[model samples]
Target: MPIATIILAAGASTRLGGQPKQLLTHNGKTLIRQIADAALSLQSGPVIAILGSNYEQIQPELADLPLQVVLNPNWPEGMASSLKFGLKALIDEPVDAFLVVLTDQPYVTTDLLQELITTQQQTGRGIVACRYGEAGHLGVPALFDIRYGSEFMQLSGDIGARKLIKQYAGDCAEIPFPLAAIDLDTWQDVEAWSKRQGAGFEDQGTQPKS
Candidate 1:
């Protein structure tokens, strides 16, 4: 089965005072660049990046990567629009599975992606998702069988793939990824993630106030 990756990088950084979260630096590289690099490195069919909001500004960052780029004009409608747009872009490709990933999850790696593919193939599940957090939240980076393409196309507004995963939980496989919960949503998140790399940042015993 040929698997393709769709990177959603269109969210407006409303919480970060208008800053582009995808442009935030982690370990010297911008978040989007980091995620794009990992996606491009995957042994998959095609890597497609969905850009919106600040598409022009983000375009240069990915100019050198080996991937297809698509713009989501209805990005203001939220994540679902980007998801639908990406799926539509890959309609003509011979893709058996699609992996939806977010650029803000700096910890997402080629290894973790490979794990999702491996689990999905081994268990023959139609959906494979990452499990995280103490409460065990299931989220991306997720892989879905082509059989779910129509379901994806039917999604609208702010709805995300998680809803689909929950609806079809019986046929889904999950891989635990505690760090997947650590995403860059605000300035505090950037600080915390930076601290992980030898920076002197105090954890303060609480999740960063989103």
Candidate 2:
């Protein structure tokens, strides 16, 4: 069974003061590029990027990379819209499982992604999420068995896969990832994380470009 990775890059970064965070150069590459690269390295299946907002600027960043780009017209609505668009686009592909990831978590490594895939395969669970504890800490970078494709397409509003996780808790597996919680939402967040990482704020190595 092949695993397909959907990089959710279609968010309106209103909190970031209207800047498209995916295009922010945390290092040499943009956040979206870094996340897409990591996802491609881990799984050999098709990798799709859901683009919205400043799609044109970010589209060029992913050029030459082995990825499929799907524009989400309803991206302005919410994150769930992008997920639905991406999943619907791949309905005919030979996808056995789907790994939905965000382009903002610079700390998410290919190793962690591979581990999630392995765990999902081993347990044959319906949903596998990276646990960040009780703030309803569920978001992208989640792997869902193909069995839940219908449910994925039904997602709406600002909701993510948490509802499915709760509904299918018995069939879900949690992979604890503390680093996954460190996402860049604002310039202050970037500065604080850089300070904590003991790296210079100007250094892009500490930040992931998606």
Candidate 3:
């Protein structure tokens, strides 16, 4: 089945003192680009990057990648806006599923995503989500059957894709992804991540930390 991947890179990164988390880098690659590359690595289906907040700054990062771009003018409305906006763009397609991923999770790998799809297939479930970290947080990077399109549009302000994962708990499948918890949200987060990677970084703005 053809599955479309949506990279949720629209948030303003207000938590990082206005730093655009999508622009943050790891191992020399911008976070947004790295996530886009992971989705593309699957070659499973179309890849769409949702941009908002810092659309101008983040859009160019994916200019060289083969994927679709949809800008959510109401990104300030919250994650639901970007999530719904992306789904609307693909609503006309005959995609079997939609894979939603956030840009800040640097450790999201192709295998982690692939297992979500694989688990869904094997379990015959409508939703496949990542159960991450020690708490086994169930959330996106998630895959949802297209049958849930109307419910996705029903998602309102501030509520994210995870809401549906919880609302439809009966049909959900899970895969362990401990690294999903590692996301860049603050200068301290960046510092900690960089130290873990054994790398040095510049203060956040537009440049990738080296």
Candidate 4:
């Protein structure tokens, strides 16, 4: 069974003062590139990125990578739109499962992704989420069996896969990942988190100094 990855990089970043957060630099590469590289490294299946907002600017950044790019014109509506667009593109592909990830999670690694994939395959569950923080927070960077692809496409509003996971909690499994909780949303958030991680602004390859 092949595992495909769908990276949602179409958000408006309204809370980040309208900047394309995925284009923000981190450790000598754009956040989106870092995420794409990590996902590609973990799984051999087709990797698709859903782009919107400043698509033109971000498109160039991913040109050299081996990834399929899909545009979400309805991205302004919210995350669900991007999710639907990506899933629609893969409707004809031979994918056995999917790992839905967000570009904002710079801390996500190939190892963590492989773990989720392995766990889902072993447990035979329809959904598996990464558990973050000491309290075991759950979010995206989740894996879903093809059995629930229809339910995934039915997702609406701004709510993500969490709604479906909640609907089928009895069959969902959570993997602890405290680092997944750290994500860049604002300049301040970027600096504060980088500082805590000892990742100076220079390490992020950004023009601005923290």
lDDT (Cα, tens digit) per residue for candidate 3, span 53-154:
878888988999899999999988888888888888896777999899998888888988899889988999999998887777799899999999889888
- Tens digits of per-residue lDDT for model 2 on 1-210? 788998889987777766778876654667787888898897558899999998887798888998899999899888789889888878889988889889778888788889888888889887888888457575456889888888977888877777788788899887888777788888787778778877644322334345
TM-score of 2: 0.90
- C-alpha lDDT (0 to 100) for residue 95 of candidate 2: 85
RMSD of 2: 3.5
Using all chains and alpha carbons, the TM-scores for the candidates as numbered come to: 0.92, 0.90, 0.94, 0.92
lDDT of each: 0.86, 0.81, 0.86, 0.83
Off by over 4 Å in 4: 202-210
Off by over 4 Å in 1: 200-210
- Local accuracy of candidate 1 as per-residue lDDT tens digits, 32-78: 88888888788688989999988888888889888898988899998
State model 2's lDDT.
0.81
Top-scoring candidate (TM-score):
3
Relative to the true structure, candidate 1 reaches a TM of: 0.92
Superposition-based RMSD of candidate 4 using all C-alpha atoms, in angstroms: 2.3
lDDT, candidate 4, equals 0.83
Error of 1 at 105 (Å): 0.9
